[model samples]
Target: MSEAMKILFVEDEEALGMVVSDSLRSRGFEVDYHTDGESALQAALENRYDVLVLDVMLPKMDGFSMAREYRKSNRSTPIIFLTARSQTEDVVEGFELGGNDYLKKPFSMEELIVRVKSLAGCALNQENSELEECFVGKYKFSIQKQMLELNGKVKSLTHREAQVLHMLFEKRNQVLERKQVLDQLWGDDSFFNARSMDVFITRLRKYLRDDPSIQIVNIRGIGYKLML
Candidate 1:
């Protein structure tokens, strides 16, 4: 049998944490649950996990800070932020801090499970792929490393960014429906998730700005086309 996928889960609420962790464990995931961000960060740094589920509010450290610090050394492991805040800014900030997905509080267990499996699947696919590199215009994208290289200068990408870019490249010069991308990565197309997708699209445009030949065009009410 395959080893159970490991997860580092941080949530301060005792009841909620127990429920979520138990649910994940029941679904065949091996989860390391922590009640505070400080200890969670330590666990995350010292161990390898398939994915991270973090609550934004916690004692000693916030999820955003933990994710930022974790990204300094590790960029490939996927992070999903859990928070009560549904504001667009909070969602965007989570993504900016290197989180691959964001789940608001009061979320269903089914949704959380779907998101976790989606992210874990993506990470596993990248790790197990044989092709290491691909090109986008003049830029070189490293699949396993999660990096974009151009002219000797390299820019690291968060898991979501790399995933978005990979999807765009796969359908290069073709319109990739916004809902399609959202469903694949986030497991839902809620308003907050749509806003988060917008933020990622803008970031991708900036990252690929060095090559004028590449453009991620917005279809206005439809979707985006990565014109190369």
Candidate 2:
């Protein structure tokens, strides 16, 4: 048999942790279980796991803290957060912390197993990946070529446009704050640069108006959202 995928699971609840560990191991995963966030963070730093299954409520350190530390050291490892917290803010916070997926409380072992397997599979697929070119509505973004094509026509993007579009496409549908966008694209958030960004946004909107499903929504004082 091929080698099992390595997984690190952090859960403070003993019973739930045992159940999850058993379920994962039964399906050919090499599982390491931890009940505390500090220990889990240490293990994650010392060892490389294909995926991390973390619980939001953990002793010593919480899953969010562990995730933040893990991101500091590792960005490629896919993290699936297993938590009972189902509030909108909690879910948004999980995503903001770079969580690949979230599983709510009182989940089935079967569903959990499926999620773990699917996310792990995606992680593995991304390991030996080529540059992925994706579409934002009608605009085709070719990361490899650094070009954007709409319909049959292609518009060569300026350097700043390409960079901003890259960030927007990466977080498609997610609101990107104006300051964040400005900083990410230009490394500055001055008034002039902000106004320049708005101009680019308007240009991009016109270019993509061919597609009715794609829109760029302004969030007032906040950033913009590329709705796909």
Backbone clashes under 3 angstroms, per model: 0, 1
Task: Give per-residue lDDT, candidate 1, residue 68.
Answer: 95
Off by over 4 Å in 2: 123-228
lDDT of 1 at 201: 93
> Which predicted model would earn the best lDDT?
1
Candidate 1 residue pairs in clash (backbone atoms < 3 Å): none
**Candidate 1, residues 83-144: lDDT per residue as tens digits?**
88888888889888888888878999898887887777653266666667999999999976
Tens-place lDDT per residue, model 2, 1-228, is 277899999999898889889988888889999999999999999998878989999889999989988877565566778877767677667655656566778878776766666545532233454646887776787654446787578765433455567667767899988898766443468764465566667766776788899888998999989898
